[model samples]
Target: MFQKILCIILFCTSFTYAQEHLIVIGGGKRPADALNKLIELSGKEQGEILIIPWASGEQEVGFESIKKDISALSPIKVVSAPFAPLTAESKIVLLNQLKTAKGVFFTGGDQVRIMKVLEDETIFKAMHERYHHNVVFSGTSAGTAIMSEKMITGNGKLDVIDGTQVETKKGLGLLPNVIVDQHFIKRQRENRLMGLILQYPTLLGIGIDENTAVYVQNNKSAEVLGESQVLIFDAEQSKEAMKLYFLKKGDKFDLVKKKKIKI
Candidate 1:
C-alpha cells in the first residue's frame, strides 16, 4: 500500500517534469549507444553540454574527456567551470552557463567530493530546476553513486549485512527514493546493496554492473543498456518481502510499478 502511494507520487512528479531524463553509467567502458543517446536526447544540434569534473583528481582531463567524447559524436557546445574558489562573478557565469545547458555530465572520483562542491543551496536548486525541465544528467562510478539522495560512501564493514556496517551521505538527490551502486558485478557489491536495501525498506537499491547503464526517462521508467546487467532490490513491505530483480540490456523497468515491462 505504501509502495503504491509512492508510485502515484512519482507519476505526479514526472508529469510535472516532463522532460527529465538520466543516463547513469556503471563505470568501465561506456557503450556507443549510450553516448549517442545522450547526444540525441540533449538536442543533437542546438543543445549545450556542461561537464562537472570536481569529483575527479585531474579535473581538466576529466572535463576534456567528456567534451571530446561527446563532441566526436556531435558538434555540440561543451563547457565547464570549476566550483573551487567560487567567486561571485564566476558563480554568476557558471549559473548562466547552466541556464543554457541541455545536458550535464559528472566525472567519477569521490562521490563525497562532488556532493561537497554542490553544497550551496542556490546551485542545488538551479540544478534541480534545469534537471526537471530540460536536462539529461549522467555519470559513472562515483558519479553513479551520487545520483540518489543517500549515497553509499564506500566505507564501513563489508563482510556483514548489518545496518551499522554501511555508511551513506547526502548526494545529488536526483533519485531520492533510490540507492545507486556502480561497478556492481565487477567489484562484487551485492553485499552492500543488499544490506542497505534490507536496512532501508522504503527505498530501492539498484546495482549497475560495469559497462552497463540504467537509462531513466521522464523520471519514472528505467531501461537497461550495454552488454551487462542491472540488479534491483526492492523491500517496500518488509525485509522479509525484499525481492531481487535482474535486468539485462533491452529490459525495461517501470519505476512506479516496480516491475519489468515488455514495452
Candidate 2:
C-alpha cells in the first residue's frame, strides 16, 4: 500500500509538468471556428485548459460563454479572478491556480481595472515564471491592451482626445517595447493610435481590430489572425514627421521589415 501511494504521487507530479499551453483572445466577438482553431494550435485538449477572466470587472459573463464554446472540443476549467472585495486569500487562490494551470487566458473588459488589481511584484513574478516555463498567456480586447508596456485607456469616442486629453497609461509591461490598442477599424481608433505612436516613437504600435488577434511568441515575432489586418507602425526607419495635428485617418506608414510577409 505504501509503495502504491508513492508511485501515484510521482505520476501526478510528472503529469502536471507535461501540460504547458497559452492562448490570447482579443475581445470583440470570438467566432466559434477561431476559438476551436486556437485550441487545436495549442496542441492540448480542451480538458487541460484554464481560462483567466481577470479583466472583465472580474465578472464571469465574457468567460462563461467561451468556456461553453471551447468545451465542445474538450472540457475546460474556468477560473475567475477576485474582484470588488479582494482579500489576501483570494489573491493567493488566483496565483495558485495560475501556477498549476496548463493554459492561462485573459478576458476583455477594462484594462485599467485589471492593472490596478495585478500590478504587484508577486503577481508579476508569477506571470514571468509561468511564461518562462512556456505557459501560453493570452487576452482579448482590454485584456490584450494590458499585455503591452503602454496601453490606450478611455472611451472609444473621437471627442475623447481633444484639448489636453490623454488616454494612454502604463500597462502590465508583459510585452516589452510595444503598445497595444484594440477595436481598431470598428471604432475608428487609428487616429488615436497614431497619436500615441508619435508621442512615443520608440515603441511599436500594434492595433488589433475586432475579431482579430496578434499572436506573439517568446521571440517577439507575431502573426495576425482573424478577419482584420494588424497595422504595424515602425518609426525606426521613417523620416516623415509624425505631427499630432497633421495626422489623417487611414494614412499608411512604411515599416522596416527584416523579412517581407508573402501573404
Off by over 4 Å in 2: 1-25, 31-34, 37-43, 83-85, 155-165, 239-259
- Score each candidate by Cα lDDT: 0.86, 0.62
Top candidate by lDDT: 1
Give one digit per residue, the lDDT tens place, for model 1 in 1-263: 99999999999997876787899999998767788888888888888778888888888988888788787888987888665546778778879988888888888888888888689788888888888887899888888899999999899877887656889999988986899999999999888888888889888899999999999987689999998999999999787768889999999998888988987
Q: Identify the runs in model 1 with alpha carbons over 4 angstroms from their true place.
A: 1-17, 83-85
lDDT of 2 by residue, 37-109 (tens): 4565444554345566666753677678667766776545545555524578987887887777655667777
Error of 2 at 230 (Å): 1.4
Taking the candidates one at a time, how many backbone clashes does each contain? 0, 8
Pairs of residues at least 3 apart in sequence or in different chains that clash in candidate 1: none
RMSD of each candidate relative to the true structure? 6.1, 8.3
lDDT of 2: 0.62
